[model samples]
Target: MPKLKVKKSAKKRYKLIGEKKFIRRKAFKGHLLEKKSPKQKRNLGNKVVVSYSDTKAIRKMLIC
Candidate 1:
């Protein structure tokens, strides 16, 4: 059987913290930062765990 290929994009964007648990950068921090409050900007900088609803698809792509 052929080896299963992982999604390169997913590999780059998401990180494995543990089995079945993935972390990713939060959105809305890349642009328009000047208009957003400092608190909001600070909060956006942290990595967040993937939601349970979407975890399966991401795990499939990541081959976890």
Candidate 2:
């Protein structure tokens, strides 16, 4: 049988921590920042954990 390879796109976007948890960058930080409030833009700079419902699926893709 062929070895299962982790998805390359997923590998680049998400990171595995310890065993079960994954960390990902927050959304909406990529564009249109000029009109957004400073606080909102600032908050987008932080990383956020993937939600609980998505955790299992993301872990499979991340392979960490």
Best by lDDT: 1
TM-scores for all predictions:
0.87, 0.85
List candidate 1 segments past 4 Å from native.
none
The sequence of per-residue lDDT tens digits that candidate 2 reaches over residues 1-64 is 9878898998888887766678899989999999999999999999887777888898777554
In the predicted model 1, the residue pairs found to clash are: none
**Displacement of the residue 12 alpha carbon in candidate 1, Å:** 0.9
For model 2, the local distance difference test gives 0.84
- lDDT per model, in order? 0.91, 0.84
Q: What is the C-alpha RMSD of each candidate to the true structure, in Å?
A: 1.2, 1.3
Stretches of candidate 2 off by over 4 Å are none
What is the TM-score of candidate 1?
0.87
> Per-residue lDDT for 8 in model 2?
92
